[model samples]
Target chain A: MDSYQVGTNTPIKLKVGIETEAITMTYPFLYHSEDDDTPYSMISPFDPAQKPGWKQLDNGNKVNGKFFRVVSFLRFFNSFPDEETFNLAIQQVKDTYEASLKGGDVSPYMMAFELKSFYKDKTCVIESELLLT
Target chain B: MKKIVLLSVLWSSIVIAQSGTEPTAALQNIAPPSSPAFVLMDITPSNIIVPENIQAFSLQTISAFSGDSSNGLSNNNYAVEFQPYWYVKRERMDFFKYNNLTTQKADDSEVTPNDYTGYNIFGDVWKRFSVSMALMNGTFDVLPQAQSYVSVGARTRLLSFKTKSQINDIKSQYTAYTTFMSSPEVIAIFAKPGLSPSEINTAITNLETYKTIVTDFENTLQRKPVFALDVAAAYSHFMGDKNQDLDDAFGRFGVWASGDLAFYTPTIGTNSHVHIYGVFRYLRDGLNLNEASDLFIETKTDYGVKMELELDKLSFAYEYITRDADDNNEERSIGSIRYKINKSFTLNGGFGKNFKSDGEQVVLFGIQWGLDYEPSVVLGAGN
Candidate 1:
């Protein structure tokens, strides 16, 4: 998945195969450059009004001698009946990203994100962050 | 890869510990709505409406500080409710579709609140589903002495309807919040450099405009459905006295259904409603001790109605329930009031007459509060 590279202004599609029973929350943040030493800026698509189906992220901003990185917070309702199924779904997400990358249809950097889940407010939260350079 | 592996191991261990073992302290701290103990004690109102914003986990307790032990219980009772849907993993969920935020179009840019008419408050079955367990020690009129009992209950909303006007209010609030978020000042805060995530969050939360919009939006989200139907079932087991042979005996089993009709009264208050509720319950009670010191079962049916006036932070209600059985008939008449001090705390009081109590008056008071659990997670680390 890390072999392919994504160029500036490329459009990346984010997909999760698991069927959700409730609304999924998504928060997007953009980092200016690799060594900017500043906090990431929260981009468009505000809370409670942002459409959840906007999976295609247009990574159009580019500056010479600087690299842009995106980080998204995706929160989904925990509808799985058991942990095994949850683990399988996470694997499926990774697999889908890998498949998309290997098929040469999209750049590997497009799917350069890591998925992790942790306990929050007595609930489970799955967070994904961009791992691109 | 190592972090993922470590997380998997940690999650697996946590799951194993939680699957069937004794509940941990964190699990016990989860707040709940009215529990089986409250139902058995007839402390809960007959209305039984599901809360609009159900917490993932909640804990509710009836303490002895209320000073009105009219129900023959001197000890505190504790209950916990859990909604599994919030703790499990979910897949393929489209937020816009479930929340009525968009039309049935594939294009995201074209999605608008005008395209949607109503949002069902009880649309998601998972959000409505809840399991509650309670522990209480009390003396019942049918029993010889005080005993400890454990009760388990489950409740869910089966159907609901919402008015078009309520949806419109929500849409308008959503638009207002969107505009606020898009304002240049708000954008400048997010665009400012050197501000940490927590700093940014604090700034956003402290903004008066942001706070007002969020509070209004939340109140709009909390509007009651025009009508809703909910069903619940509960069972209790007596631990029995040490000198008695009735240990682990069945205490009570009941199944009930409740229907509510709510009218939004913006004239009285922006966050106000008038609710009429009807409830029916069937129960098999086995706590009665006969002349031979043996427990006996009685089949009973109860039907009740409640009328409530709900304001933004206060509510008053009156309920009447009549019980019918082969041997006797009794009625419960109660008036209750609740005051919400804040988001996490509430005070409740009730005054009335209880069923089959030989004209004994009933007075009950209690408090409900929730624990806020927030654990921080670092983001944007490479895998």
Candidate 2:
């Protein structure tokens, strides 16, 4: 609903809000510039001790353009009881993000979070795209 | 009848004693697979069961309880089926891989629907796995009167195969959707200044092209697989009479497999299919009580075939199954009809002769419903 001004030196801040009863998780937002079609992954660092909630992506020079696309992947959790796997996956995602900050090459963090096989449908994919001008 | 009432009261007392509350909520929330309820009613089309759809959480009751003598509360049966997968949490880190958006080509080409078909098929099997539990009050052939029993069961799809047409249809729909998303109209809507998320959604959905493409794609996705195989197993336990020490006797144990061959029948309706099913099961029965009130076991094997015509919201099916045991052979022939009143509720009825019925006809009716809870999504600006 909100459009961003491109070509400005000001940083672009994008925030997403979710309303759901299920546990919610999100992947790093993918930013694609009109100048270059390649998608740049933007990660929002979180304090491990705090609860996960809305994530804000702040992009400075990388997002300065007339038009760009922001792709976000959101997952909602269901009542399936596999907490062990969920906790482990969350930890791994955080670990991968931390490693990437140190110039790690592996993009394993890009893999979709895994759940026990049958409960997959309990989850829904909200793949949204935001257009900036 | 007196004994049945006493056993029902005893079971109710036990439940209340354990939970310290009235059993109304708990009783209303139990649902079993329709096939098993048929078996309990002695009107099962076949002993080998293959449930059509499994919900995350479902509830079913045989007779409505009105807290009055006329409503048959004592004879009520309740069962529940749930998928454990929905109970677990899952997180996907590799978004590109899960959505099949990753491409090796350097040109930044968009991923096609063909890229998604494989992932979808792989996920379909897991969605079919489910577990069920039921509490029922009924009379078996060897029992002098109705008694309470409990059953636990599980089912899963063993194999599923879709036709080439199904795959191609998905690909075509995906291509259309991709084109529609990038169309000038869509881009203009997104480029509009000061448009709210809900407003944008409404505008897009109101478009004729958007509606057609989405509805067609969804309908295509809902088509039945050309062929599928499913397996299930269940075990039930009988509770002894009210006056005696509770005899936790094994009531029935059954393991079965079923295969379905379905053909799309769009001529009848956009969402219609003709299905042929084959099933086989091995069952061990122990509800038979002798004069001394001791339970005895019987081993039997059953095989059957069924034909069903599914027309959008209604379906009609007929099946004949033969049961063979060491000392006797019995047959079950039944015709059944089902109508979906809505997404959350359905009505089912079946009539015919059951195994060992000695030509006595049986008619049974049932209802199934699920507790529908869905998460809502809202898009807004970041503060």
Candidate 3:
């Protein structure tokens, strides 16, 4: 509303877009489980084509771009069958340091994921250097 | 793969051109003053296609048109193709199925009626990785009485090369155009000196009237490229949850970018298009659109320079832009003419204009009555 001026005039109050990325490529609907959680049935994977470009000037420690992944299907259905179930699946595969994600969806994607459960280091990895909007 | 075999042979020739019942034969090749059916989640040459599960059913009639009579009418409550009537005006991008799934004191708390669908497709194994899981359901189908909404989106991409690719010497046809990149904070706010650089270049050339939307997003991000990106994570619920009356939820992002470079093609040896396309859409609802009276939010960021030349039946182009809602809005020039009007017709006309005059100044008339006729009519009429 009359304040966008990223020119020689500079003003530029708001309204600018172009940040892309934070999530690389993947597809492993390939399964391996223990009543499932081989990373949660691979949480729906099949991205025929993806690029993850733009959003440079990565300094400020990279910050934003990660959206929790369905609240870990609500803590993996709130822990269905556990005996320490790999330490509650290693606290649901670690990473997702909870910077600005208290709940689920509504513009949430700091794009985090870095869990490690023994027996094959249980992977969920999606911390692609975080820098997407 | 060849666009999934040309959309599965256009969905089996539109289901054998419909017979017994009236599935409407692919909505009669869509777009009779309202063609809307775009479902190609994402294709990048700068995010050239992220139509978002697109679903369209239309036949608008509130007693309109019919005056100068080019003829089209019916009686219905469905008015699709009003730029997709912002699709059901955003009921959280729509997806419903709630036959009672409550949860409270009975189990302490649960309401399984979330029927989430905020870009959730997560699973596309080998056609190359693509994952999805969107669940914002907040609201804002282009300001649908928008006072609140929330969104969360996720995306992925990779195709360095395998299954079909060749990197044409690392893409960049032209990137040498910067006269000291002027931006002394935007010429120090309309610099003084009796103010007159042609009235600030004819009022910023009125943002070059959008040069036909920068030649239709630079001719579909250079016809097609490889490895694309589009991330749309949004969360908005303006006015939050006031007594559940709600209207202030927020978080946002909508980005589309692209990159492609491949060469050597006698007729498909190894080819690539889509040099670079970077799109970004955002919204942060502090609400207060000046207390609403014409609440506005318009932003279509840009930075472009592209060229293509595909001979043999011909396909050529040129686009140059640095847009931000143009007033002379900077640049655009497209001149196209494709004519195959035979084997199922094809005749698209063109000519886009705008040099620097803030966005959308037009004229691009078009026609193709069934190109030789087989349910084909590729038009481009603009103004």
- What's the TM-score of each model vs. the native? 0.70, 0.65, 0.19
Predicted structure with the largest DockQ when compared to the true one: 1
DockQ of 2: 0.07
| lDDT, residue B36, candidate 1 | 50
Q: Model 3: how far is B144 from its true place, Å? A: 36
DockQ of every candidate: 0.18, 0.07, 0.01
Q: Tell me the tens digit of each residue's lDDT in model 3 across B1-383.
A: 65345435533543343222232222222221211111111100111223221112222211111111122211111223211221222211100111011123222122222212122122111112222222222122223331323223333333222112211111111010011112232232123223233443333223333233323322322333333343333232333554444444333334433333433244531222323333333323233233443333334454554454444344444545454641223344444444443322333333444433244422222221211112222223330
lDDT of 3 by residue, A26-103 (tens): 222111221222221212221111111111121112212311121110011111111222243334234222312212
DockQ of model 3 vs. true complex: 0.01
Runs of candidate 1 with Cα error greater than 4 angstroms are: A1-4, A7-65, A69-104, A110-133, B1-33, B45-49, B52-54, B64-76, B93-103, B106-110, B117-122, B242-247, B368-383
Q: Candidate 2: which stretches are off by over 4 Å?
A: A1-133, B1-53, B64-70, B89-111, B115-123, B242-246, B291-293, B371-383
lDDT of 2 by residue, B260-285 (tens): 99999999989999989998878898
The RMSD of every model to the true structure, in order and in angstroms, is: 12.3, 11.4, 28.3
Rate residue B302 of model 3 by lDDT.
46
Candidate 1 yields a Cα-based lDDT of: 0.56
